[model samples]
Target: MGQANNKTVLLPLAFALGLAGLAFLPAVHGNPKTFAAFLGVSAALSAWDALLFVSTRRGGRTLSVDVALKKQHYLQACVQGSLMAYWGYYWPPVYAFAPFILAQLVFAYAFDMLLVWSRRDVYTLGFAPFPVVVSINLFLWFKPDWFYLQFLIVALGLAAKELIRWNRDGRRTHIFNPSSFPLAVVSVFLLAAGKSDITWGQSIATTQFYPPNMYLVLFLLGMPGQFLFGVTTMTMSAVVSTYVFGRLYFAATGIYFFYDSYIPISVFLGMHLLFNDPATSPRTELGRIIYGSLYGLSAVWLYQLLGSAGMPTFYDKLLQVPLLNLSAKWIDRVAGQWFTLGRSLTARQRNLAYMSIWAVIFAGMSATQGVGDSHPGQWLPFWRQACEDGRAYACPYLADLETSFCDRGSGWACNEAGLLHIALSRSGEDLRRADPAGAAVPLRRGCELGFATACQNLNTLTSGTGSFARAQPTIEDLPIILRGSKGEIRERDPSALYALACHEGWPDTCGRSPLTANSLP
Candidate 1:
């Protein structure tokens, strides 16, 4: 490849890295080594394509080189999609996720082919559907039990691409990006159905690595695509608007709107890759600004509203894109109107209108502001029920409730909290702050309340001399500690044998025999 091709890829790639550096550099937290590892790997993966795109070009300015470049794009998509699926498969929650990913990809590819075979012309060797399916599936991997629901999402998203379109600028264009549309619609449904109460852990946290290596790779690989579309303006506008809006929101509400930092890596991907879908977004300059601003504002509003209502904030940022996509025609017309009007009016008047519109929107948002749930205690019952119904993911949340209750001086709750902490710690995450002697704080608290089991557990943890892991309790211990002393018996209960009954209504004679016994308590 020549200098021109290098510039095309390199410039946007540099711009993306620069923005990431600005966001992450100032407020450094977490392990730098982890972040560095992610950054380096992502850069390498991204550069692999860049090098290929550069090296595989035909000799000189020929028509076939353009065709070859197009093929490179498709190859890049395939390579990236394969790599992403492999990563998802190999990532934590391993086996359960990989099969679903393969299933979705196969379904998406076949669906796209059927559309093409019927003369609908939406097939691209799985390029379009592959990324959409894999990325969404990867994000939704946290809730593996909801396989049927995930399948529905993939089907609906593909169906939307074929079915939903509008006549725009003398050509029919899909109203929404396939994945974005389905994600937005499903997010709303999930919130309404109370499904959002379940934990849909962020993409990064779901990964085995600390710094979210998968997302970092995605952000890098996605940069060239964003550049190819020349929608960097939209990405910039959306990111900047979100940053400013978050600050203003925090100032007014005293609550952090997004993450601890405004522009986390996740936010960067949401802005650039998800929100800036060139096919669905507006083409004109003013339209891009309005579209991006609307997205940023709508995201913040939806996040606050849904999060206040006790729904997960995982999909809040991505939900508004499809909603906004529906208004592309109107937005294009408005941008055109602005362009014409700007030629007639003074620059000051244009600026005034911009400020005035934003002011009104912000003012309305402020007036309708809701006080989000300050106390997570209120959601304990619902979370508990969800946890009970085979949703093992709810353990972390139940632990949170017990922790909160224990903090309020409930001795039993303290014990429960200690047990949960130990359970979680045994499973790879140590919620307890004390290292080596995990769960000691809660156990000590319970012990002070005359809880014998808590004291014993605390002793086990601190001493670090138990064959049975101190972080977890035995089954027999649960019966003794949880059931109290009322059912105490020196002998083990034997399997009962029924004898002949004299009357229908009479209780039958039962026989019991104990074979073996061991010292327990």
Candidate 2:
């Protein structure tokens, strides 16, 4: 009886942990709406689990097939519908999340049909959908807008299925039991609250969503609960047997990679793309891009190495132990030896190595035409002309001096040129030659490339010169402008805030405003 209870519990716990991993993916992509949806679904699922518990306890008997099937279908449909509604509310234009909902429903129906055709029991039919849901949730995390809704639907389905099993059986006795339900509930609330805070544009310092301190608090708070739960769920005899089995499994097989390599790389790429640009300074951009690329490449390389080695075998799964410690230690030893060898090179050899490195660097720069030409803002025809002529380096100085530098490939030059055009429009120097439409191209590109200063400059030019009269600030642009203002204000500057206030139709400066003052803090 004790062993049977253990099996039932471990299954749900494993499913819940997998769902928690799915919940984190939205936060990874910085999608507040999706993150919120993930939280909501988690909460709803947890509530469903509670409902199942009450039902089973009250009945004092295993759940009937009719009760379980109805609950599962209802939960799946409700979750799918809620996610669709969220997507429609937050991201209607993209219409990206619609397909995921349809796919899930179709897959669920197909699984049901297959079960019927094979003459399997309803419980077996329900279990068949678990792996499919897990795989879909894993795939959906790579997309920013699609992740939250997909995860919520799939996770809710899994939770409902597990609850049904527990309802039919008195108590779980698996490696991943439902005893961790309390922790799962806590995670749901934390994730949901974090997402809600982000959506309302609340400050992170005040919000627990991504705060460093909150993570520490959660870690400490959950440790005791985990320990107590583990103790109560499994007996000492079972624990000993499992430990021995785990050791044997570790000896027989190696570690498995359940998570995908591309997910992390995609996440890094998305973050770097969002944060990279001129606003951060060229030095910061260089460091960020290099570091991001290196991390992505390293992850991919490790995945390839692991896949070639055939890790995470049946023995590892049966024992429930990771098997990669030995390989990791061996790799570390080899790396240390290689680093020591590198440090032992003679001065003459180092000099030759440095020369070769410089040659390669120069060749790469020549091939890519340096940062000036390749940067998004530097793609103007004039800047390209200058870069092609080998005079692109002078563009920034020329822009600062308000002179039309002939360097066509310089981002600084394009920015200056655009500003000049805006200034000319205001001064009535070139009404016939002024290209207000053309001016937005460089300004927007510069803004997107992390030039918060450039965004501030563009805000000034557009709002001041009447170019932005008909345009409304996009939801995406509001956060960028707000971030830019905070950066400017930190430097004891108020220009970005002033622009934002003016854009919002404030008569006075940002700091002096009655309505806007509250937004600053």
Candidate 3:
């Protein structure tokens, strides 16, 4: 009976792991290296499970399926549905990946069911995995060739809720959040291994802005969760704190600190989705405020920290969640001890009050161009000027944005990027490998694309002639807005944006430096 129980427990996990691995063979069969990794993971899981079976002893354990309708999860499903409706409509990749998403749902439920059954006869299951899978997908996905990792990601999240448990009150609960735990773990491994290219980590961070009114969509879709879960305080504190910190950073530096919007759409999503898990977040109202505030401030700090390390900045939202989850109990305890958190109002009333304040602040952000569908910082031209103004961070970002435009067949963008590298050389900033010859690569591409000035500049450099004059960027020479997925998108929002810039009439206010300190910190 004892040995049989061990088999029951380990066998299902091994089975689930094997099936999940095999499911990816078709997706990865074209590449030998990727296929080898997939097979290796499968073999490792099998061998580990067999070893556990041989070495471990266990008495027969009773199991039962515990069924409870968690309103928080199902309601989150409704919210995710609304988010998917709009996001999927805008980026059809949402639809393209629908089958895999559906497969994972099956895998999560099956894996959770089997894993639970291994220890006990009763397994409580519902839509618990829905939000976990969807949230992780929104934040990160392995590119198509490496899509097999997606299965492991989903499985890890599901298993976290089952395996990593701690005592709370009279019962047990998972210490880390299901979705965040896996994402944070994977983020660290990727960062340490310096292997972020295999995943769409960067693209997901940027392309989240592809949908229209994404900020507004996030706000509206988040309302039900806020109202029902009484997490409004957490959301309010997070948003306000991030906004406050961003304003202060702006005060110190001429740059808009986030380098995009006052609050980037992806980070905004993190504020709402990543850290606001009701179960994982703090319990007391004051604790929730502390939790949210810390998340907001930490996100800002991590953005700077990650950038300086030359790693992906998308990890800013992810890295702090598990830490917060672990500290939640202590935060509540500290709040109860040190602060006067006596409540005169009911939890519902308190949540509504917080939501009302958030509404006003959000409106203010929208009106003042703090965040919206469009912003001055989103313009490539603004960053180009900043790059030329000798901002080290701006050069790499400018090169990236300009490369996107160049990929869309914009010869002028190619020329602009080449010139920016030349400018970088002059300023003694060597962010991009510090190579002066890097200028010729883009310049040659622009010349081939039939841009007369690019051809002239390339000829001037390669023909042993003296350096050519760097062309000054003007309205005519620049691509006004980055549009499509590849920066080929054309849209009319630029009209209103520029009209506002021209109206502000600040010195050089062609939407470049509209507000903030005139000097860097």
Candidate 4:
């Protein structure tokens, strides 16, 4: 390929990735359109790079060979990559795009190099694109129909890094975190234009909790970066602030404001990984404390704001970093001028003290069920009540939970989801989205799946009957632990038809736990 001594050979690796991507396509799990667009973009980029090099005689001989690499970039990339792999163990949607995500790494490299070299003579390449591309993929991705937009988001971020600048500590620095700037900007558009469905933002937020002990997984993955970079203060402060705020909120309202935890898994993820970028974040310890506090407090505020506005709250973490980045210099200047008590201690010592405090707090939080696998909010009873109470995210979450169960062939869940959908459609209070017709889909499926209640509900919905005419789903009972096959279970009480029924998914019979199987001892 370089027989003519071509300066830009159009990365062979890009073509290699296109071949690899077919393996992850629809048969296994990805949207085919998205992969096609990605592959096409890869081809176009290679063609353009080769054309530029051949014609202009100006394109650099090597892509980023002359650029100095930074430790934090690759370190952050590894951490983010490990996280996605672990989470993918419990979720296919996250894993289905392995090749596509890798393609972004190539895109970021060639496109970033192309953008730079097209403007100037010498281009310095490093691992700058690694963290940026990987981080964006970690949080949100586009639907296949709108897959091209994902490229736009990536382009905006990469370009903004080069175009947007401010003088910080005598060097021309980016005003906003490269990845975060595009996220916040795009979020504003999504919220304002009512187009959030184009991306998988909310699905990512919910599915993130699917992995067992995910909170701990994230904490462990985040520690190396914290240890190496001395960014513990920011993470620690953010955690403490959010934990305290959530505790106080629960104390006042008797409900967890963040829903499933004192701190939500995804938001906690943001605290650890997303907003703690040392380069764009506050440099001084005091400034970091304030910056982290604001991030935490603003997350709470933004969650409420977005929720109240009927927008997805996954944006809460994203919308703040850009704003915080804009303020970081001011914060450093102000806090540096104000706080001088730490002058006696070495920077390393202060960082150690911060890490020590954070470790203690994290331990306490884990020990106290503040950010772990088990929480009361995870139960159906809590969601059932919250849905009735019109908590902004509650009905949708409850509906999603039941719908997932329905998809798994649980007729009881289908019935439950149909009821919730009907209620949501009729109420018209929160999102004002009425999917009355969509309610029949689940009810009909439930009936076909052998849940009698769902059959009755389907009849009610299809027969043009009124709203919720049948029954509301009850979480007062959970499925009892039946320990045998249908035949063995029936053999326990050979005459008991109800035994057969319970084993066959009769909610009324299966609902009674063995502990309460009989009231009279």
Candidate 5:
């Protein structure tokens, strides 16, 4: 009995782990060395889980399919999210955040154990680890830097499962996809706060990382699971709609809706893995199509609207999924009513339905007022703070905004700007291509400031011998306009404009002059 139950959880987990490894392989440049920690941690956790399951089986325990499924999802979320954290950004802080991650998992496991213990026969976490894992993974993928926020999101998502339900005709159901709802809610909140970091896991998009072989490998691996979940239709529909609608929007407004290509690997993963959750999406064929179409449309619409409204694009799909998720009950009801016994919409009715959805999208997008960002004033303070704090991520955005000042003789500023570009050039084809010469402008300025390291780095970049960090900036890190140069260099700082590129902490600059350090810091 235990062996049977163990297969239930073990098979899916192994499959997911394999797929995740393949998917991240391209991004890691076929270098298994970088995945050392990721593999170690994942193996340890998975082994422990297997042992626990096997022990319970030895004690005459039998696992239900529901429990097995939950365990699979939970395992996937924890394992995949951790891998993404390590390989995605290769962010060192993941080690520091270990305690929090463990705490979150412990709490989730304890919560389920308590529920089962209290009501042995009646209580079962049917979706056991799915909701919890998804929430953790999403946070790890997007905002792992903000550990408190991750904990908050996990708590809120779990809490909502119990607290927020609609009771109708004595049949109660939660109105939101547990994992997606809190993400959507908090994403909006963070967007408003200028802290949302939605990049859609481009860190593992095989194509983006320069090697395409593993891309095919990952697609093939994930296809079986996607089909098994009956999500291929939804995933395909969302991808197609995103492309077509995105192109339409770009043509109409001269704005590139999605920075990456329409069908990047990340989109594939998200459409199948995140948005098309079997529990939240409609199960019916036609209903799934509508659900996916709505997702694509909502994603595109929100991308444009929120971007113009001064929020990040990270929340576009997050917001869209939950809103559509909330309508799952109604979608099923309508699908049932419409698809019953030889009932099919006529061509005209079908067109009308599509038109109505489009109309809503257009109206909603048009009606969204600008949030008083005529001068890009909203991000100015944020960028300035980030720059002052030596926040590396703020470098690219501020570099663009401060270019004119740099050109007009802010030597230190120009050097700093160059460093930002170098930082950004660490990842993404578009960004990498933008600085083919590799941060020559700012680095030269720093060199001119007598900063020896700046000279060395500038030499390294110019000679094309410099290497990038294991975790570097992606498309999300670039400012919208600076994504591609589109062939324009507005600034060539003249020698007349020279300032010391020195701050207290930059020891190389300190040797240049005490005044330089004082001035910049």
Candidate 6:
């Protein structure tokens, strides 16, 4: 009866395994379309497994171990690891996936071995592995080569586990166990070697064995070396800092949230530094400044919240009154309104009165400040008037002209107008028919105002050269233009294609050949 039941369970298990094998097809290079077909097959297999599981439960029969193990959830993880390996082998040109496979394996082995040794039942292990595996997978996805070192580190971790198990009686046999220390040392060496190999290997070969000159160069050029160094340094610092900070916070405020907040803040800062692509556009300089200011303010606020405060003077409290009182009032009012109204606006009349007062105050301020006169070529007003006068086509005409509004005070308008002129020039239209050399002025102004695309465009017309002939594009600048072009083209922007084509030689530019071909019109 047990054997017969096992065979019945094997049906779903077999189906899930087959689906997993099929799913590998999409991950293969030059066969991404096969992935869709495999996805459908996987979905079907998942449904079959679900039905089997439900039927078994309803009939008061537990799924056999083999059957339960063959579920799509487990199969999916195995397939995902295999997919990473396939990508590591085939798509090495785009990204390295080897570390991902390694990381997944390490996580699985660690969780399984740990749980099993603890004598925890299989079901008792629950879905904890899922989130742990997923988080590690995402970390690998972001930094795949990080996995190579992690594999070696896992051995040290395993040793640590054994040592902890042996010492569980709270008695130390020796300060340094001979068996433990060597394994730890070897693990550290392997981890370091793996990191160095990733970062400096390619660059050394390219530059002919010269060590990186600048600290930043290691990170920008050396992927593995920089990654390993950064990971080790940050991890060590974070562990030590957390311990110290925790002790201090506990002693002072008895708060643990401050420690919890540390990781999030550190991660945020790291991401901003690592991932926030710096803008090449001149207009973006203003944005960068604003972002910097906001970041500074946030840092101050976070410190104020987390740091021990010296008692404030009476004057200090007076200065803080506006921010504190306004925040308290806003919070109270919002909570009251939300609870009282549920969905409907119970205080509609009061709300309208408050809104009208704010609107009148804004209007009075704008009129007193003479802001309207400062914006003479108001595109919205012109469009609205033209539409009221039954000119349905005027909007498109203005868009074509790239003259949505006239505001000499507005840098954005000048930049857009410049782009419009450049597009007209590209379309083989003679701007000389209307403004002669005046067309170049907007293009030049736009470039000076920090519009990088405009700068490249104006360089083509005025400098009698393209961006390629000027100098090698910076690493930061290339990705910005490429990514922007990608987004713009995806949104059906015709002009972005030309920008993309011009940056074809950029190292990070993906699908450049197709873009270059498409841009030739």
Which candidate's TM-score is highest? 3
How close to the true structure is residue 378 of candidate 1, measured as C-alpha lDDT? Answer: 26
Q: Runs in model 5 with CA error above 4 Å?
A: 1-100, 114-127, 139-146, 166-173, 195-218, 249-255, 263-268, 337-521
Candidates' C-alpha lDDT? 0.52, 0.33, 0.72, 0.73, 0.49, 0.33
lDDT of 4 at 502: 53
What local lDDT score does residue 260 receive in model 2, on the 0 to 100 scale? Answer: 11
Name the candidate, 1 or 5, with the larger TM-score value.
1
Tens-place lDDT per residue, model 2, 1-521, is 01222123123323333444454643332567655554554454445445544554565533222113433333333433443343334334224444443334333433233223223212332433533342233112224454444444443444433433321124532212111122223224434454422221122111211222222232233223223222111111122233233334334432112121112212221121111111111112123223333333333444345334543111111111111211222333444443443346754454345335434543453354221112222112233334334442323322332222212222343455566556555645454325665566666665664445456667866677433222222222333333210211122234454455444433343445433343322
lDDT for 38 in candidate 4 is 67
RMSD of each: 20.5, 21.2, 6.6, 7.0, 16.0, 23.1
Q: How good is model 3 by TM-score? A: 0.82
In terms of lDDT, the best-performing candidate is 4
Q: What tens-digit string does per-residue lDDT give for candidate 6 at 101-169?
A: 333343444333332323321222233233224322322222222323333333343343345332212
- Tell me the spans in candidate 3 whose CA falls farther than 4 Å from its real position: 1-66, 338-342, 387-392, 466-488, 491-521
lDDT, residue 386, model 3:
77
The digit string of per-residue lDDT tens for model 4 on 155-257 reads: 7899999888988899998777788888888888988999999989888887788777888888788777876787888888888899999899877766788
Tell me how far candidate 1 lies from the true structure as C-alpha RMSD in angstroms: 20.5
For model 1, the run of ten residues with the poorest summed lDDT: 497-506
Which model is ahead, 3 or 6, in terms of TM-score? 3
Worst 10 residues of 4 by lDDT: 481-490
How many times do residue backbones clash in model 3?
Answer: 9
Please state the error at residue 255 of candidate 5 in Å.
6.4
Per residue, candidate 1 scores C-alpha lDDT tens digits across 355-381 of 455435434433432111111122343
TM-score of each: 0.51, 0.24, 0.82, 0.77, 0.49, 0.24
Scored against the true structure, residue 489 in model 4 reaches a CA lDDT of 20
Question: TM-score: which is higher, 4 or 5?
Answer: 4
lDDT of 5 by residue, 1-521 (tens): 12334344344345325423532544332445424433443454356546645665676554443334454465446445544453334334444444444444544543343333222322344445544654445433443323335545665676666567785436776666767777778766766776544433323232222222323333344354453444555665676577677567545643334533343434444565677777667856577778888887787787679766756555566777777877776777787666542238754444344445533543343243111101122223345555566544344456664454455444445555666675556643224326646568766775675545557777777777875222211112222212121122232231111111121122232344433323322
